[model samples]
Target chain A: MRDIVCEILSNKEVGENIFEMVLLADRVDDIQGGQFVNIQLPNKEMLLRRPFCLCDFDEVNKTFTICYAVVGEGTKVLSGLAVGQQLKATLPLGNGFLLSGKYNKIMLIGGGMGSAVLPAIARRNKDVECVCYLGFANKGKVVLEEKLREVCSKVVVATDDGSYGESGFVTNIAKADLDSLGVDAIFCCGPEVMYRAIKKTFADVNIPIFVSLEQRMGCGIGACLVCNCKIEREGKQGYYRVCKDGPVFELKEVVL
Target chain B: MQRRTSIRVERGGIVSNLKVNIAGVEFKNPIITASGTFGFGREFNNFYPLSDLGGICTKGLTLMPRDGNPAPRIAETKSGIINSVGLQNPGIEHYLATDDKWLAEQDTVVIANIAGASLDDYIAMGEKINESNAQMVELNISCPNVKAGGMAFGVLPASVEQVTRAVKNVCKKPVITKLSPNVSCIADNAKAAQNGGADGISLINTLSAMAVNYKTRKPILFNNNGGLSGACVKPVALKMVWDCYNAVDIPIIGLGGITSYTDVLEFMICGARAVQVGTYNFTEPMGASQIAKDLENYVKEQDMDINDLVGSLILNK
Candidate 1:
């Protein structure tokens, strides 16, 4: 809701082509888990702002963290910034997860860089017992496990190559214990295929499941109708703005 | 050039007069938020006041509510974006019931931009919007005419005149024909709208463009082709606006990739009485308002009335 100049506190590579950056900013008290900040890249060539989810926030330090993968030229430019550099960002954008609901056991699933937002979600819902399932392409791609463990009650990691943690997709691990774990709620963020797989795996469970989506954004705000996703409404399908209506939505509410 | 010693200052000490009159409709300023980019003017109101700009063109409304295209509706190109939103809007009835009151209460002028697949659809929408509180109706001829087998109405002068004349006959409010840039002859299209009794003309609705995902060997946008808009298209838009200006006598509302006050001046110099800020709204939510303020300062610096800049470009032939 406000544009602020954030000073980079630290920027370092946490994994292959992945980075973790902490920024010192003011007025971050309202920023919750699952919400994102649109960071204006310092490069003049790139006009559009990049949206990154809030990996974590420190109210006491007046700082926030964003974990991004260098998938494009914008992030490549972002990776070149030093600790003392400054960047303008629009913060606390889009609706975050509905964390106020009463739940004793929560299952959080993240795939690849999608795992970035899970730490913040776990941190905010400290009252609930949080179990995190993180999937990576391989052991070399794994990240944020220790960060998730700081706030989550349990952190489970999966890799396709079996080089780390368990030898399979995160859905495989979740499928085995999802019903038996007494999970009261579920939240996920990953590729479209992964979301589809998770939705099917937990179809029988009558609990609220939330998923965060990524789309090619224009304004990162709701003004541009570019980042639209189909959702079910009144027994029919309708379109929702991912930037405003959600980057996060109840699994059943979206068609996926 | 001699520097004038006297500086005329308005009530607020800004010498620039931003007010503009187009087709007998008065605007507080010349910066109108482009259609489709501004939505219902409610979303950006969260960042800045709607009253800050001269006008707001509502999202393209159709006869019936449309769900729009499928996922991956947008793709980013060099300094621009391709979008196939397909005029996803609540039908005109929904607008009159929901957004009309809110729009009427605003200090800004409300121009309803409408689209349809046929001439009847255009007339029906125009008639409905004319009965509402909107000050003007912008006929979106850029939309593909499903009845005409997908060819857009704005691509040809004959169809452009046909649709404009039909809608202008039934609509009570001033009609501004929004022309597409995908045509071979933009000037002819502008003249066609004028000949059909359009009160004003808004040009260069997104250029027909495409992008592909090389790995998948498929188009990035679900619709395969989309309209391109942003900084990348500004130069082409400026040229088209100039072309349209020379071809018609009606006031021109130039748009396409307008970002800053300078771009606004460029359009005005090319004979646009007013300009619309489109894709830039996505990058800076308060861009129109910011440009309006900057324009006041710019005119003051030049020691000239804002109107003096309109159609001032001296082409060396």
Candidate 2:
């Protein structure tokens, strides 16, 4: 990964503390879904590097986008980056979702900020019909609903509070759709509860379901065993690294 | 502000070799970026070639996938940091199937750090890593801030012994058990690991700590508590290393808030054959390699052999 001094082409507020920023990168080759770039925030006072999952990538335009919620000082600084200001990043790191000849139909489920990985997954697998199930707290906190609708065959939105699309969690609506559409596979990136709920819903379904696990990654790459999660297969269980082994895995494989 | 010199200093018409050997296995150098700090050596390669380092201890891998804890997981304190990431990860099979190819190609010792909630969990995960190109298994028995069988197994010397014995039973390669600093007696724990037939031991994982946001009247981290790291915890970690050094004869890999060559020297003097850079990598991108260079220079400047510095400062009580 090359550290390029990127100029913020545009910064748009997507939700609370969440901003979508388009960066002009000279080095944008091999960028894909589930892959993330490490950004070096301004003012060296903030020591650690902040990582944001790639929301979308455009090679012809020499630009890629990142949608992140400013949860800390590092992100707050990134959100304040002006259109002309220079930002540094270690681009195209971590193994992304494998889209190679596996399934015909895929259900992309995202919750809150995890919706960041959806657009890229949809665009790359245009041949496969993508059904999206997005969960939000309320209508006011929703993001990328319209954009997702354009790419996916069917876009299902669910809010905890009955202020939008479906009045329950995205998994409930997804379970209802499974009888008719019967998704061949599932791709998810969201809160733990949402994923856990989805895991139970698809417990009996003999289909491949992948989910992206999140952690406070010290290094966006894998070196530290800091991000460890428990797993079980055929009566045996152990730990897995979210950064290296995943951030993507089949849901059935998860013990959660 | 002046930029720090990242250029490699030359010596004797040769690029200095920083390779390290532990229990017959050769690491390119003694400088291994610790688990949870470097990721899989892939991301660091984006900024700098990962092959330059001696080795990498991958983030902990389990049998099944886990979503980990909620957000607000990390909280930076005065001189250290506290985190409750809750070991978020995809399952081990996924890693072996997907990331193994990329991991094998790297010219570094890929040490798979394995963690589990139970004995069965440890054995299963160790078996998976044994099937891969992973050079060794760094059994992570020191994750102090997590619930659900993680920190509990690490805190007790008996459990440490059991887990080490269990993992060593399944793993084909060397098993280095990473110990928790949160324990009351780290030496006893180290002895427990040694008795359990651990090939080597890595010290001072993380100290249990926390920080509260006064304005919000809540803990800064989402988990309400976290493991502290960075320069601030160096002394505590050093103490643990010193204690473990005196208690056990096994090779010690010292860690916790190592930021400079001075800190590395301190650990070496305390009987660490090698050092793992943890939170320091987050502070400086090339902190580990830079420290390695500094150690080499310091050795040459002091007109001393590299081995001479090992255990040179024991207080013979």
Clashes of each: 0, 36
The superposed Cα distance between candidate 2 and the true structure at residue A138, in angstroms, equals 2.4
Which pairs of residues collide in candidate 1? none
Candidate 2 local Cα displacement, residue B226, angstroms: 6.9
Candidate 2 Cα outliers beyond 4 Å, as residue runs: A1-7, A38-48, A72-74, A84-95, A153-169, A174-183, A199-207, B1-79, B82-227, B234-256, B260-276, B282-286, B290-317
Q: DockQ for model 1?
A: 0.63
lDDT digits (tens) for residues B1-317 of candidate 1:
22122344433344556788998999988999999888898878878888989999999999899888876888878888889987888888999899989988989999999999998899898788877899998989987788999888998999999999999999999999999988889999999999999999998899899999889999999999999899999999899989988888899999988889999999999989999998888777678889988987887777666666677789999
Predicted structure 1, TM vs. truth = 0.95
TM-score, candidate number 2 = 0.61
Q: Give lDDT tens digits, candidate 2, residues B231-314.
A: 888888888888888888878888888888888879878878788888877766666777877877876566544444556775
Query: What's each prediction's TM-score?
Result: 0.95, 0.61
- Candidate 1 chain A: minimum summed lDDT over ten consecutive residues — where? A40-49
